[model samples]
Target chain A: MRLADNYEKNGDLIVTTLYDYARRIANQVTVVKDQGRDWDQLIDDLVTSKYFGYPLMFLLLGVVFWITIVGANCPSQLLSDLFFWFEGQLTFVFQLVQAPEWLYGLLVLGVYRGLSWVVSVMLPPMAIFFPLFTLLEDLGYLPRVAFNLDHLFKRSGAHGKMSLTMSMGFGCNAAGVIAARIIESPRERLIAILTNNFVPCNGRFPGLIAMSSMFMAVGISMASSSLVSALVVASIVITGIMITLAISWLLSRTLLKGESSSFTLELPPYRKPQVITVLIRSFFDRTIFVLWRAVKVAAPAGALIWFLANITVGEYSFIAYLADFLDPLGRIMGLDGVILLAFILGLPANEIVIPIMVMTYLSEGAMIELDSLSAFRQLLLDQGWTWLTALNFMLFSLLHFPCGTTLLTIKKETGSKKWTILAAVLPTIVGIIVCTVIAWIVG
Target chain B: MLMIISLDQLPVGESGIVTVIDAHGLTRRRLLDLGLVPGTVVKTIRKSPAGDPIAYLIRGSIVALRVNDSKQISIKPFSEVAINE
Candidate 1:
């Protein structure tokens, strides 16, 4: 107890108790005989093999994404239904009390709706994604992932740890920026910090999910839209991965020009993942923390969104006015005011886009029943959405500037206002360019 | 003086002992912790597009180290020179 206390209180890097535990385990670990082995050549043969290496890497990536998509669906729907039902109950109770109309609207519609959306949309996916990702981290597949891409990164003149940072981008760009510390080179780290936004953060996942499900309903079979949405989400994530590689390559040659640093990667031994621990750790550390942040941010955001939709200026609400201002830019990208409005309000969290869009569109249509996917489709049809618009929206979601939280994180991570601004703007530029080009060519 | 050599300059399929560790400080410690030591037999595993940081095999595992870091460590390429005349 005293030793544990000392370890906890002291300013020390060495975790003595943890080291002791590691040492105890180390004794039982027989050193794999260092026979006259040529391990470097062997790993080289495997990773650099013209055919096998990259294909294998892609396979692993697809498999991990597939797992995330397949796993997160059920709980997301259930949570959404449960929360909405709870909201109905609150409204009924408030109505019975004869509470002031403004009080009920402010409390239930503004705050409760926002918090419920945060939990339902963000929780299920993160609950599944973070633990699965933590499993890979625990198995040390990340080092191999870095090893696989090190040469490419070197060619780009970026530090190898950018590979790991990009992987972190899968979960959250903010965390990905934080992971840049693992790269010791300041120049390379800067390059990573700048391009990290190319890998879509969690805020964009909802947009990806909505687009994926809506378009993939091509087959006559009845598999449900959530399943299709999940697939689209996975593919969009794959697109984000491709963009990271491309941008990294671009930066290496242009802004950060230097020789690539070569370094060895050590694959830690794999262990049987402890399920109970994974659940506890991931739930409290990741899902709940994100949920809490979303809830906090969503309160003001929801109130503001409510205010904008409610308060009108000369025949148009604040939202409509803002969208009108952004309409020209939106039109150039083949999107209209409503879509642009959704993206703007989605700055707090991507998960709220569908809900917020539903609310706004309902106001425009005078009604919308969003209980299921079909009704949602009807709402979209009411707005005259097309395949082109959906495609553009997804591309914008994947490529645009990150959410407010992620921007703040980039600022904190880089400690340079200039880079932080670039991190946000570079991707916005890419989104607008690619989106514009596609909109033009497709049209 | 200029020393700009591509990673392919290294003999393919030949194993060499690591002599130095040159990379990011975080990467160096990570490599060291992974059992990369001077005089350890390391075989090149793979090369990426344009080939600079070549992946290597050491002590029954795989690692990727860049050409510059690899160059810092000299190697006596394994060879058999048989003289039977």
Candidate 2:
């Protein structure tokens, strides 16, 4: 009988017998090295231990987020100041050249500000995060991460490799979707691609951080406030992980029904991470690439937002009308129309969501940044945002649709528009349901 | 007499020689690629918390196999002193 037919006929017995036969000969011929208790074994004992594995994973995740949040602040401020200065110079030149009001608004207020915001806000985190992540990958910790999570994934009827891709989603969901290619099973890969959006990416960090600071850290000291913010974000991340597992299990049972494919993951030896090489690779490959994509989508969206906010239909601008139209629905979900409109308009890039919200609130001709977290909190309050609204908003943001680029990435990865549409629709439906439930309870 | 036991039934820290991998298609190919071919020795390393998937050391690498998949492969048990060279 042929191998394929034999597999169909005898099921698993043939494969096991073959391996058993191979073992018999190998024992007879080969003199295997008995490196009884190597360093790799020692480390694996702790990392893959049933007890400590998961706690260590969560601890490491918290550390990474803390470092990214604290480390990005100074550089983010410096970049923001520099970019705003450059924006001022550009506006002055445009005025000196007597550029038309519309052209000045479109080019300076819209495109320039959009690009600058994305770069200043996004670049530092990616610069910090990607290298740190790559260092883990280089040190062989990531696979052990896979090793540790393997059983949970297996229990969910999903591939063990989903753990790695989910971690990749932290930097960028588009990259995470692309990283799903590492999984050989097409079914599990689809599951990974569809669920990658649950984990908020670097682009969503500003909004998450803003909300965390304004609401979560109400009375904490400045030193511990950032720490509190980090913890809030970490818990949200944990929530995202729980959701991912739940969704993965759901998908496995319903849409992508098949036994999870088994594969051997060779845990590579831990080595000294080549710092210079990793830095250059991460800087060029991850930081620049993700920043460029965000900037590309953000600039056009920025121009559109500026036009909508500036062009008045009688007294209220188009954006105002949009917010008004969305207000009733948004209220049902414990958010204002302006907040909903910002999320809708910020579909191109998540990094712009808070800025769009700030612009909508200020009703300024351009997106504006508050000088401090207190001002941001006051602004949200003036918009009638309660604690419930903040909680639901964060949950909604965490569960909503992926940005345009990520949807495109899903389409390309899945090669089926049906799956891509499902990817876009699934989380959005969940987000609405979750927000509504929360809102109803709070009310 | 040839004493055969399923790989999943093999106790932790005990080594066995693979005898029969009764699986097919991609799964069968995967097992072979992971050096689970006949004549190779595998030792059950550890189990996760929930304990369905067990880790095994095969060809010097730790490969995790769920009980469902691992149970299909049969192995011949060997004493540790037999292979101590």
Candidate 3:
């Protein structure tokens, strides 16, 4: 007790002395220029103003998403076509080499398709999103966002730095998990990691967008469909944030009990973002790294999926049997058996969830390509989807467990399987509860 | 006698000379890193939308600290410090 008191006193003394020295030097040397008006006044007035800050943030983020959605379309299509063409060439080469049928099925049909799906679907958006976010980071806007949201986080009993991690989660949860390092307190850091998955990452955005465009945009014309979809997506993002705060509050109150430790954050001066460096770094560091990990898991997942679809016991294949088993539970959750099976299989990458569902519904027993969103909608309609199904599916997609790469990141970050397992199970439990409740109510 | 007040109590647009930082170990270290040391002049810039956390210009950086955290550090308003000296 004496030693603890001494330590406390010493800390106080250090702070006093440091302040004293800083004041003395500041008084003697500090100079002011442009006395009344500050250099950053305009930007600060706009960016941090109570009314404008939020609107500006939304507008900027919307612009980024707009560019990503519009810019990524052609490239995504081009890549998909190129990969599919290559698949044909690979099959021809296999036939020429007299490769066995099962070998071709496993290697070419299953693994190659899986790898191609991940690369094509996952690459374009991440390639566009990360660099844009990084550009904002470079401009020093992110810290201001952190600054603005700090109070809410503090009130939630979480470290203010969580705002930064939450924004990073918009790109990828693994990146967000890594970004949690900014939180100094171990307890608060854990809260950040555990709650990061609440935000919809790029991987899940396609699924969310598809559902919103199909259901929410019904009766809206073509031009405004995009706007309606954006609004719906924005609402879902807000819901994710609310859930993040709620979970953070619960964890702080229950498991990680402590005062949310205060930290000094220097709101650095905004500068022009360096485009070249930002692009290269985000491309190689974030885009490539996340894509590579997804592919690694996806290839094996594809092989397993193929085996599940192909291996028939008596009459029904394993996937069909599994979906049948899950059908009752899925109905309670307002999703079909095929949808549930797709989610279970989509464990490797959230990007594959819709594809897996489409594949399952078609009874192809392997992942297949969809020609367009309308065709995808037609498949869902044929499966007997209502607005409730679409809503619940989107809810499930938003709230479900993070992908395999994100799970590995959580394990690596916490260095404790206990926390990692909790991280995985927490969201799944929340997803099931929320979806079930919604389903129960709508019924 | 020096008229000391919690930094959060300092009026908007007024500057203060930090005198004592009465915070726990972790918070103290963090405050110091932000240049909240004794002799620095911090000016209150503005309040947030919710009006609890106030932005203060400290050591050439604009920082927003919640009232709860700001209340831990004691400072003398510029006029009070000038009169005392």
Best by the DockQ measure: 3
- In the range A367-424, model 3's lDDT, one tens digit per residue, is 3454344655777787889988998898898888888888999999999999999998
Q: Candidate 3: what is its chain A TM-score?
A: 0.84
Q: What docking grade does candidate 2 earn? A: acceptable
TM-score-best of 1 and 2: 2
Residue range A1-443, candidate 2, lDDT tens digits: 68767555464456557656776898999997766447777887888777888788777876776787788878877887888788789989998999999999788777777677677767776788788878988888987777766777877778877888887898889999999999988889999999999998878865676677668877768788778777887788888888898899999999999878875566666778899999999999878877877777777777887888889999889898999999998999989899889888888888778767766676643335544445567778878988788888888899998998899999988888999889888998998899999899979
lDDT of 1 by residue, A310-350 (tens): 78889988777887788898888988777878777877676
Chain A only: TM-score of every candidate? 0.82, 0.85, 0.84
Question: Model 1, A261: alpha-carbon shift in Å?
Answer: 2.9
Instruction: Give the candidates in order of DockQ, highest first.
Output: 3, 2, 1
Query: What is the clash tally of candidate 1?
Result: 18
Q: CAPRI band of model 1?
A: acceptable
Q: Which fraction of the native contacts appears in each prediction?
A: 0.53, 0.45, 0.51
* lDDT score, candidate 1: 0.67
Q: What TM-score would each prediction reach against the true structure? A: 0.80, 0.86, 0.87
Docking class of 3: medium
